[model samples]
Target: MIKQLPISVSGSRKYDVRSQFAALCYRIRKNKIQILLITSRGTRRWIVPKGWPMHGLTPAQTAAQEAWEEAGVRGQSDGRCLGIYSYSKETDENGHFPCLGMIFAVEVSSIADEYPEAGERERRWVSRKKAAKMVDEPELARILLDFDPRRPI
Candidate 1:
C-alpha cells in the first residue's frame, strides 16, 4: 500500500508524498566495494533499482525484487533500511509526484544476462564514489558516499 503524506511545496500549496523501496546493490571486488547501477527506463539516467511497495513483501524484500527485475541482480538484502531519499517521480500524464524511497542494502551474489527489463535498461558496476556522482538525486548520492557495508546497520 502506498502511504501518502501531505508535504508543503511552496507556501500553502501541498503535495502528496508517496513511498518507494530501493536496493543499493553491491559486491566486493579486489578488496573494494562496487555498487551496481541501472539506467532509468524513461530518462536512461543512472539510478539504483527501485519500485513501489508490494502487498505481500517487506520494504527490503520489495527493494531486492526490484533489483532482480531491473538489473538481474541475485542478492540478499540486509533487511534494514540504510536511508531514505526523496525524489520527484515523473508520470505518463506529463506530471510529477513526490516520493520518499527507503534504501536497503543488498549484497549481490551474481548477475544474470537475461531478466525482466533486460532490454529496457543498462546496468553497470562502479565505485561508490563514481556511482554517487552518476545519480542525479543529491540525497541518494550522499547515501552512496557514506555507505559502508562492513558496518552493522
Candidate 2:
C-alpha cells in the first residue's frame, strides 16, 4: 500500500510528492546473488525498473510489470516491500518532482531479448555490491548492500 505523506509547501509553491513501484530483480547463479540493472531511457543511468502505480494492480504487481516492460524480465515478486527510496523525477513540462519508490524483490526466472523496451535501454547483471555503487540514490544503494533474499522480510 502507498503511504500518504504530508506535502510540504515553500511559500507559494506546493510540492506534490508521488509514489512509484520498483522491481529489485535478482537471481542466484554459481551460488552467488546477481542483481539486474537497467539503464534509464532518457539519462542512460543504471537503475531498476520502476514506474507509477497502475489501476487495479497492487504495488508488487506494478513493479513486476515495470520489470517486464523496462528490462525484459520474467519474474515473480515476493510480494514484500524491501524499502522505499526517494528521488526526483525529471519531466519536460513541469521540471522535477519528488517521488517515493517502493521496492519489491523479484526472483527472475528468465529474460527475453525482445521485450517492450529492448531498443531503448541496456541491461546488465552484476554483483549486489557493484549495483549499490552504480546507482545514484543513496537509500537504494544501501538497500542493495543490505539485501538478503534468503532472510525473510
lDDT of each: 0.87, 0.87
| TM-score attained by model 2 | 0.88
- Compose the digit string of candidate 1's lDDT tens values, residues 1-153: 234332223432123337888999999998898999999999999999998776567788889999999999889885778899999898675488888989999999988999989999999999999999999999999999999888754
Flag clash pairs in model 2.
none
Give the Cα error of residue 133 in candidate 1, in Å: 0.5
lDDT score of model 1?
0.87
State the lDDT at 21 in candidate 1.
85
| Native-to-model Cα distance after best TM-score fit, residue 85 in candidate 1, in Å | 0.5
Off by over 4 Å in 2: 1-17
Q: Which ten residues in a row have the lowest lDDT in candidate 1?
A: 6-15
The TM-score that candidate 1 achieves is 0.87
Quantify how close model 2 is to the true structure by its C-alpha RMSD in Å: 5.5
Model 2, 1-153: lDDT tens digits are: 344332322343223437788999999998889999999988999999998776567788889999999999989875778999999898676788888999999999989999999999999999999999999999999999898898754
